[model samples]
Target: MKTGSLRFANIHLQEGPIGLLTSSLRKGRLSQTYIFAGARSVGKTRLAKTFAALLQCLEPVTGPDGSAEDAPSWRPRPTSDVVSVGSAEDAPSWRPRPTSDVVSVGSPDACGKCLSCRRVMAGSHPDVTFLRPQGAEIRVAQVRQMQELALLHPYLGKWRIFIIDPADRLNESSANSLLKILEEAPEKVVFILVAEQVERVLPTIRSRAETVLFQNPSHHAAREAIARVTGRPADEVARVYSLTEGAFGAALNLAAQDLPVTGLLPLREAQVRFLEDLERFSGQVQERVNEAPSLEAALAVVEDPDLLLFPPLLASRKSLVRGLLLAESLPAAFPVLFSRVFLDVLDKARKGLDKVLETVIARQKSAYAAEILKEMDRQFGMAVQNLFQAQVVGLLECLRHWNEDLFHFSHTADETWLLNLDRKDDIMALSLVRGLGFAESGIQLLSRSLELLSRNVQPVLLLEHVLSSIGGRTP
Candidate 1:
């Protein structure tokens, strides 16, 4: 309909899947549904979005069938034929001869800058949408919405494209909901579900879509490519590679986190306060509960995060752990360590129990208090599930960087690229108090903690030991 101004960028390290899909498009053999499964950070989502852009590009490189490559005219409605890129031919190139030029995309290419491509890349294309699990699972409500929208005609492009990332997150009900959509989607619509593991996805959904596989590129090549993007020296790249264990996403994040080391001072302060308050107030809360004759008489001192920004609430240890895996993550995670989990419900239960001041009333407080604690325990259990926690290695890496920067700044006091710029004075003060020696010892302690953690040592004991050892020595 319109001329494509977009060009495909050779950004992925793994080009096999790209070439496969592009060649399929040229041959007019695209499928109605595709399962682009791969390891995390191998570019499945990136490729999926790029493909959607190509489909919506104003100037599409016409396929062997009858679509126009450079046609200057317009076709508001797609010919009820093409999917994102199917394998079987829809028709021979025998439609009305186009007045404009037609060039086949032998290699993967798109006029990425065109109006259509731009909208698609920006994720604003009327015909394209993305879906991912909001929390632990993709609910049936989400799939139902997708199904309803899939039946509609394209608002701009000839077809509608739905990209579902980490599709395995669909629980049983949601997966069933998705399966129905896949089984009955229209010819002009396309579904691309990207997943890291196929077994987690329902087999019926898998059966309906063509499974496309992607693998990690060699670490040497991945590092070089990452270095190009980061503009870091070879040695630094090597360090990142080693830290990330060849994961490009992790490596990129580490390289980009070159901020002032003092930015974590507030978060560090919050963490200490939270831990101290948690330990300090629990006994008082129990005492108040025991003394109270009725629920109306209970009160207690506790932690809250009203002063912090909290959306998608930092109420779970998994979320807290994830948020703290980077220096950038500390503020979010640190507040959560003090913030109430499931605050709305927890508050309702607490108020229902006639308690205020965030008291952890003892089970002996009466039936109401026991019920409140029971609910708290249930919610807390859910939050502490292993599935939600951030990787230990990630947390360690972030801590390692924090202490490393403090050590470097203590002597050099350089701010070329501080990770915690906001806490410059605090960092300087800490450096003054502990000096370089204290920092080096803190780093060693953290390293030992990581080593013990990796070896499956008791997490609570190891953490307590590390905290105790570093307690007075740190700022």
Candidate 2:
């Protein structure tokens, strides 16, 4: 089959809620209302859109008698970059050859070449409507408009499909209005609700529709699907899969980028210094910025290669957390290769952790620990930065990632599960320094620093306190 023939809905319909849709289609038991539910970025909206297109297809894959038949093209023939469906005559007449066997659940479908399908796919179909969140919630007015549209007969297609994306975003008034439609919607209309969190949707709404559960594709499935679309190398496809948490749409976004995402230049140096300095439990992390304009240098080094890195000269605290998570999974560790370099420091940190864990946790108490982490996270986001504070957060985030990996390596002895698989060599080298005990304390040290920063503690003071608490040199 040619590449474009792969309609996403048909890909794994044999499994999960998709299987039910296929069964319903074959048995001619289609639901007027469907709720497609799943994790974020796991194809809920894509599935909903494709299903809506199918409902609007003039010659759907399933024939009039629901018999096995030639599937019509699911994609509109290339006319213009913009869909701008002009006339029915403009649709290409290419039809997929019929299969003699009973139509399988995997039947390719939703021929897009037809005028009706093109209009729906192009989002120009007079009968199809999509209601999404305005800002944080889907307001009542949008539902009223959709309800008004539902009363009209099909302008050019068989069904009037209203798709509510992130269905959970529907406000109370909107949800009640939607419930009214669910109770007595027009015969030719279909309602498809796509949501990441099914629980957030009103129960009244849920009771009136067929709930279809979508799922995240397996790593292998993600790799294949993305590779088929992008025609990228296997390694590149795998990398994208890892980065996007296996969401096809998210994967497609990054695959379109000019280059694979590498962290800003300082990410590398900062990561290296953080890991190296931990071995000494010293003040070297600050030393990297000791030179004037060095902070600016680090900030400058954070170039925008592809995947939006902390926005131009602005790094949100949220981005730092994301960067740390990236460091955990994607292996950005560099610079630290020799275990001999930081052995003494790692030893110092463990002893210091023991002493401080008692004193600080006692003096500051549990409430302080809980409150500080939130404060540090909040402050990092307050302003642009007196001096690339967000960049500093990013650096420490990388360090935290290293400590996590080392802790996992020493305790679990499973490198396969390591997030820094690319930095396996460096991690292994560092793993030999004080093993699990020190790695655990190192994690605590970073955690404490995060909390300390939240308590209106100066960054330098926080760094020095961590160093001292962890029994490290201050210089």
Candidate 3:
């Protein structure tokens, strides 16, 4: 087996930033440590692995060599192309490059026949390291072990590569451990750190590495990848790709499950209806401060990341708020004006700002646009923090309520909610509430509360804040 390499693979290569980065690396000018910053499912991990493979490929490739020994290592076999005219015609499958190429990924591009490549593809490669958070965070101990491993020579390949996924998950200690490695990395020891937010990592780490940004792929590219990988039709692939918001992993995951296009109907309808609801609701509240509590509840549900409908709603809310402020209409929308305290949060709902920015760019002043962007970012950050806190709150509330419900009825001092928590859904629900121990009861209560609150009735939403008096518990 040869070392794994993704160089010149038959995969449908998406053009743009990722393509540019890959092209540069193929020319053998890779950075010591690379920060691949992008949204989830933007192929950050995939690209990093591919680059690592290329760097580790033992049979180093050069441009179309004239010598016989330098001949192409692999060639595409015979295949028929779809006819240009009339009915869709069948195409023959290309041979030589087996489907295993997609499955077995490693450095120096895993040649199918090499023992090293085969072992790596089989997940037994001693030289290749893929490090991810074992739990909520990547601990310093885990990172230290990785560093120790990095200090040793590669058991097989010339280069030793370490890929840290979601590198932002590293706690301060873990990150600091990695910083030491960066300071004294041995020659040919490479680090590829993939993160959803590059800024979250230590600035020193960012300064030591080149930042390679990965932009979202177009619907066309996502569709092609889904089709090629899943053998699905173009229309079906397009549907799933669109529904996933062009997240390749989400789309491909759906394809693997063989879910039908109709499966996305509710998700799509919810997105549209939720946006309209927020626009109409925000307009109504724009003149009423007394309505702040109710509006907040509604916004919470709309912005629920699980629903994926909040971005548009929040974006609409931002625009409506700005309009009211500009027109000196704060008195009319007292509740909304009060909520404006959190307006800095509009940033996390990226989908909305992406849309709003496009609309405002044509008419809004550059200075005003800059201000709005800044506020949006603040709001976005706040929204994320609030969401996390809310989840934690939800769990505590569920636990308190579960015990209250149990003790209130049982009238026994020796009882425990853990013993009587029923139903898998209840447990699943509590897990969603976040920060609560993943006990069955906690999960169930969270699930029930979320379901009840989403209906927009505040009275039925009492459970949402039941834990306000509960002891503050850290996640």
Show model 3 residue runs off by greater than 4 Å: 1-13, 16-28, 60-113, 228-231, 242-245, 260-475
Q: Between candidates 1 and 2, which one is better according to TM-score?
A: 2
After aligning candidate 3 to the native by TM-score, how far in Å is the CA of 166 from where it should be? 1.0
- Cα deviation at 272, candidate 3, in Å, is 22
What tens-digit string does per-residue lDDT give for candidate 2 at 107-181? 435765678767766667788888866545688978998888888876877677889987998999999998898
TM-score of each model, in listed order: 0.52, 0.55, 0.46
For candidate 1, give the lDDT of residue 236. Answer: 67
lDDT of 1 by residue, 59-135 (tens): 55533344344222211122234434322254322122221232333343556667877887656788898876544
Error of 2 at 355 (Å): 54
Sliding window of 10 residues with minimal summed lDDT for model 3: 74-83
Model 1: worst 10 consecutive residues (lDDT sum): 300-309
Alpha carbon deviation, residue 473, candidate 3 (Å): 37
On TM-score, the candidate that comes out on top is 2
Pick the winner on lDDT between candidates 1 and 3.
1
Ranking by TM-score: 2, 1, 3
lDDT of 3: 0.48
- Report the Cα lDDT for candidate 1: 0.55
Residue 364's C-alpha lDDT in candidate 3? 38
Best by lDDT: 1
